[model samples]
Target: MKMGWRELIRMKQRFTLMAIVTTLIVLLILMISGLADGLAYDNGAVVRNLPVEHVALSQDAEGQLTRSFLEQTDQPAGTEALGVQSMVLEKQNGTKDDVTVFASPVDTVYGPKELATLKPGQVLVDTQYAKQSGTAVGDTITDFRTKATFEIVGTVSDGRYSHAPVLWTTLETWKAWQDKMKTNYVSAFISQDPIKTDLATYTQQQIVEQVPGYAAEQNSFQMMRIALVLIGSLILTAFFYILTMQKMKQLGILKAIGIRTRTIGQGLVLQVFLLTTVSFAISLLLIWTIGQLLPGDLPFRFEWTTSFGYGGLIVLTAMLGGLIPLRALKKLEPADAMGGMTG
Candidate 1:
């Protein structure tokens, strides 16, 4: 390990080049992972943040809440009926923003610290929507089509659906807003327990996957992340393998002089660990800085646990790549190495 440290220090340019590559790849992976999480949240935050585990949808709805049109009779036994409506919220200035209204028992929808059980005409808006529309507590926002108004009681963090902001209100208010088809607006039935109804049931994750464009978006990001990790691993392996070939005679001389192959292998892996550690540190700083500079409306999020988890995976793969050259090291003929050195 000491020898490897000295070698790395001596060959600054070579190690620095490798570190740069690792850093770039780590940055790409982190960015893609963040985007995946952000888009997933944007597409399904309403379902993801609900304090329920199971959702019972109408048989013909195919697990999609938006397509589910239910009567009170369709609600599963012992579950709360939750309705979702996508519409536009119009500001006094005629500016309009897309909003998905969630109508359920006030206690069922998660809200910010300021929120309590909302009154009949009061509603909780998504923080993103509050920011976008400049709507705050006590402000009344009008529904575009119906011109029905709701007073903002508070804001809910990460409350969105299908890329639109979400507003939470009592089922009574939502029911009053529907002048036609008053009996068929229930979108889904939610419960923490497994639903016992005849309707098709889905878990929270399954419901999120059913959101339009959500599954496909996540799959694409996942594939890109996997590809980047693989490419980083392969590059590490190829670089270290070439490095080992260049140092073959030197390694053989050390082996002949009593150096254990295990110790040599450990040294190489230690180098990989050190390299990845530095690269991860740099990548993390870059990611955080970029995240800070990004527009607030852009769906980007960075979490310590997720970033560190990816870093750990990169380090593990890099160490494994470092070990690939050990086979050649173990099979080297000391005499042949020396003869080639002499030649």
Candidate 2:
């Protein structure tokens, strides 16, 4: 390790260039990872935050809450009915915005205390939607289709569904609106107990993934991340291989002087570790700073767990890349080492 540090300091310019390349690659990976999480949250925050382990949807709905419809009798006795309606909200300025109305008993939603006390004609909205529409407590917004007005009672954080803001109200309020629309079915059944009905049942995570565009978007991001990692590994391999080629003559001289092949390999591994660690730290700092400057409404979430998780992968890849150069080192004979001196 000591010799590796000395050699790195001696070739600081070359190593710095390599570190910069790795850092940029890691930055891209972290940015994409954060965007993936943010998009997933935006697409299905409501289902992800439901306070239930299992959800039962009508067999025809195929795990989708919005499309599922179950008559009160169809809901299993042990489960509670949850109503989900995709509707447009007409702001006070007469502009319309997309919203999903969730009608469930307050205890079923993992939301603010204000949600539990909601009465008929009053609703809680997603905080993001409230900010975008300038809707606040005591403001009245109308349902564009039904023309029914609801007073905004409060705002709940992370309340979204199918990329639309969610508005929370009681089942009774939903039933009143349904009477006007002549519809008579809840969206799904939700419970901590396993749902044993003939309907399609899914875990909360499965339900979240079924949200429109959720699974496709996440799969796309995952593919991009995999491509980036592969590209990065190749780049590291090429860099180290070229560096090893350049140092072959010097490595021969060290071998001729009785340096053990294992010691030489240790130095190379140590260098890879140091370089990857520095690159990861720099990338992490850059991503954090970028996150701070971005708009709150932008779909980007940077979590420490994700950054560190990717950092570990990067280090592992770097180690693998360094191994290719070690093979060349192991095959270098003392006669070949002295041949470089003679030539």
Considering every candidate listed, which one attains the maximal TM-score?
A: 2
lDDT of 1 by residue, 75-133 (tens): 66678888888878886667888888888765554333333477777888888778877
**Local accuracy of candidate 2 as per-residue lDDT tens digits, 1-343:** 6778899999999999999999999999999999998888878888777777998888899788888988988778788888998888888888899899988776654444565788888888889888887888999888888898888888878568988989988887889888878898899888888988888999999989899998889999999988998899889988988888788878887888888888888898898899989999999999999999999889888899988998889889988988998888899876675564353
Root mean square deviation (Cα) for candidate 2: 2.3
Q: Which regions of candidate 1 fall more than 4 Å away from where they truly are?
A: 105-122, 136-154, 180-183, 281-296, 335-343
Give TM per candidate.
Answer: 0.84, 0.91
Best candidate (score: lDDT): 2
As a whole number from 0 to 100, the lDDT of residue 78 in candidate 1 is 79
RMSD per model, one decimal = 3.3, 2.3
Cα lDDT computed for each candidate against the true fold: 0.83, 0.86
Off by over 4 Å in 2: 106-116, 333-343
Give lDDT for model 2.
Answer: 0.86
Question: Model 2: what TM-score?
Answer: 0.91
